[model samples]
Target: MAQEQAGRVLRSVKWRADLTAGVLATWPADPRKRTSQEWEQVRTAIPGGEGLPSSVIKGRTRQAVTFLNANGRLPVDVFELEGAPRVPRMLLLAACDRQQATIERGDTDPGRVMLRLQLPTRVDPHAYGDWTWVACPISLPPMVPVSAVLHLPTLRVTGRQVRADVAYTHTVPKAKRTGHTVAVGVDWGLNTLLSAGALRLQADGRITALGAGGQFRAAGVLAKQHRLRRLSERLHAKADHYQRLTAGDQQHDLAGKHAVLSDEIQHVSARRANLNDALAWAAARWAVDQAIAAAATVIYVEDLGSMEAKGMGRSLNTRLSQQVRGKIVDRMRHLAAEVGVAVVTVPCTRPERGRVHFPVRRCEPTTSDRPHL
Candidate 1:
């Protein structure tokens, strides 16, 4: 009970921090086979002692480094310098790591984790971009730790190789749950489906089905794809047969069949594309609409592993659509933000795929219907 209570309090506090701390690595990416002896001098020269934070120096050795601080914010475009730009950057690790270092008082962490002052997001372009081994920013969000990940790893923020100065600021979470606000759950359909219902906890908790796409459009799209697939296959088969017939008799027949197959492929591809665009648009819009209707700040979604619906091995289209769900979340987040709403993903615990467990109470009505997608 104590541990569970602590976990809840810790999450509440940690989520409120302003930024993240993670790895800022710089490898000699464009090496033209630079030699061993040269590499030694390069490596040693990388960690300059002059006016550098000791924590930054220490980060140079760890697999995942932090930005404690750098000597100067150098320009990023000067990477072509003969003996500059290799300065191993120092990063401020936002939380506890394997290092077991001394903890700082205010740094975000599980235990007493020690680190440097915060790093800034913007670097002066004129001041940045020099030094043989200067540590630079990797143009990516710092790594964040999530506790409930399984199956595929929780989607992590990655490093972008293009930027030079490193700065990570975690947006503080507002812990004050809006008493009047309600939440809504979103379920995405496979091959164009939609299910949405708002879960209102304000006043009294209520589950209201807010949106549904009638089966008519969904059935039509599915049937069209099936018919197109068959048409393309038959045309292809007819072409093969014609090509095996007498050469003099085959020319016109083969040409017509191939043309027909090409057209069918194009037609099917267009239909699928339209269906996907519509489904995504609907999902995002309804989620946002429900949030607006309930006057809520937070929206909850399935912590879908790899953003995929539960099923057999995924095909290319399925994979492509799975990726599209991420974009939907992104857009929904943006729209929600426009209206002062926050979007969150709660994990679908294995034994309980659709139910949300509360610390003080649980609601069975939250999972009144099975997943439709």
Candidate 2:
């Protein structure tokens, strides 16, 4: 009787695996034809597909449909297996209505939370009788509920790692401006990465200079550029040497040496990128910190969208563009949002009567007689 029961369990597992593989194989090429009507049509065409659960079939069909709609086509390969092809890792769909998967804190150990995956008996009757519950330990932030779970094998790593992506909604408190109203004007330039001027807005519509000429230095940018240039030259020399050797001698193998030089070139290129990213972030942080220290609620930055680097040499243009002023602005905007400070971009117009007036309320020009700044 026990041997017969084990054989039945094995057969059930194999059936589920075959069913999943079949569903993936018959995935619709047209994303529009992935509705319930289409799924039923395709399922009826496949032999033994009628025996599969409607819920499972719908879930698999929905997954494939979503992928097709987003990427404009199906994935190149569906089943990414590791060792044995017959026993594949299942991408089980969670039924929210049935509560097949749930997250809750431990009863005895309050700190220890767990994710419970309840397998339905319809998939496997004998082994997973009625409803088989498997509890896996998990850690999550306080009061955050799990929305969905994606089951997939770990890539390029050892041991099983279940990554749960959780999302929650929180209200942001209104900012209370208790201090005096201050505004900071920022000018982005090639020589000085950022030049900031702090001003205090008075009640009588008068602006006083609290501080002026604040700058953030793009340190080590030139040095890194020089290093990258040298690395490129070395890479070219090595490539030339390899080509000459390969052309002259057919016996000697220079593949290993060529690969080493290529790898070194790539490493230097990556290092240069890393350095540039670090500098951009650092400059942004400095600008934000200066604004915070000055108690400025509003920061006005020069908009460089329409500004052209005309009459400049190729080398100068490359250096100016590569400085990534836009990246600095983007980072500054993100960092400023964390606090109550607002970053606004003003048009790069020339100062009228030796003073640049930024309309804080409307952000529109008062008169159209100003030159480009």
Candidate 3:
């Protein structure tokens, strides 16, 4: 019932936003710079604004303006949705309230949580006064800390289940910026995936390695990922050939084949996404474990944002381009935040011979207090 209600609200909000998009496209003023009063006036011009809550309308408009600013165009064909509801924080209450929705802990079982939603029975109603509140139990993962502060979560439906993407806040020790004594250095690899180890700075500004770190090897997963990539490429090529042969004719003989290929491509893409997500999390967990084992305060990784895959062989270049480097960095930062470890990206310089060099300060130690690299 909550999913249904939220979907309805989202559809209504999207419908209004679509109409507003069309109107804003013709205005001389920039929609991104519109004030709240200006947006309210524009909302009055929309036909179905009266049916939506003010907060929902405001959020959608602001979201649309942001999209326009980023893409330099208004969103069109916005009514097609996948049933994901982006409810505002105000509408989703953490405590018991006579509002749209409320989530609370179970009285009998502290581990169990409940979601209460107000649902309307009428076919189409402008107000929720005649709605009834219904309660349903929800499950939370065990990894959530007991002291974390809960906030309103976004909701989505998949198969026969509704999933809540809960966001929370937890206190962690602040990371140091410049006074780091111990740090981990991470190097990128293809089959080895990552090479990370700890380094310590001495009193005389000398750096030394601690121990040989472990490597994350996922040869099977990488093989599967490449296979899926090749299959998707073949499917896209065939689909393109079929499209050119049909030339926009829906009744062509190859139309069904093209449609099937498109569906297969989507399936393969979804699999790749899931695979990448798993690999990223696993790699991040391993890296954080290395840092914790070494008692390091920060992790230094080479910045690969400007690195290109060209000049390497064709297959190696493709693999490098498809590598989940960015995703791994993001996941590493998220996991490291929980333990108060800072993930810093240092600038890397590559020579003409395609050799990457990390900026490390090296000096001969006067005393044998720490191990030398």
lDDT of 1: 0.42
Model 1 C-alpha lDDT per residue in residues 154-183, reported as the tens digit of each score: 112323332122222233324223343455
List model 2 lDDT by residue over 1-373, tens digit each: 2344455557865765565566667666563346776677656755576654454565556666677677876544334211233532332322233355665556675545666776565855665467778777855454332322223211121127545443222232223334436877887777677888788878886878885558876556855765686677789798779967777464569866776787887777777777777877888888878888898877778776545443599767656646667778877775665565777777655766755666554332111111110
Q: Please, what's the RMSD in Å of model 3?
A: 12.9
Q: Give the top-scoring candidate (lDDT).
A: 3
lDDT value, residue 228 of candidate 3: 92
Task: Enumerate residue pairs that collide in model 2.
Answer: 350-371
lDDT of 2: 0.61
On a 0 to 1 TM-score scale, where does candidate 3 land against the true structure? 0.67
Better of 2 and 3 by TM-score: 3
In model 1, where do residues sit more than 4 Å from their true spots?
A: 1-181, 189-192, 200-253, 305-331, 350-373
TM-score of 1: 0.35
lDDT of each: 0.42, 0.61, 0.70
Candidate 2, after superposition: displacement of residue 372 in Å? Answer: 35
Off by over 4 Å in 3: 1-98, 119-123, 350-373
Off by over 4 Å in 2: 1-180, 229-257, 308-310, 351-357, 363-373
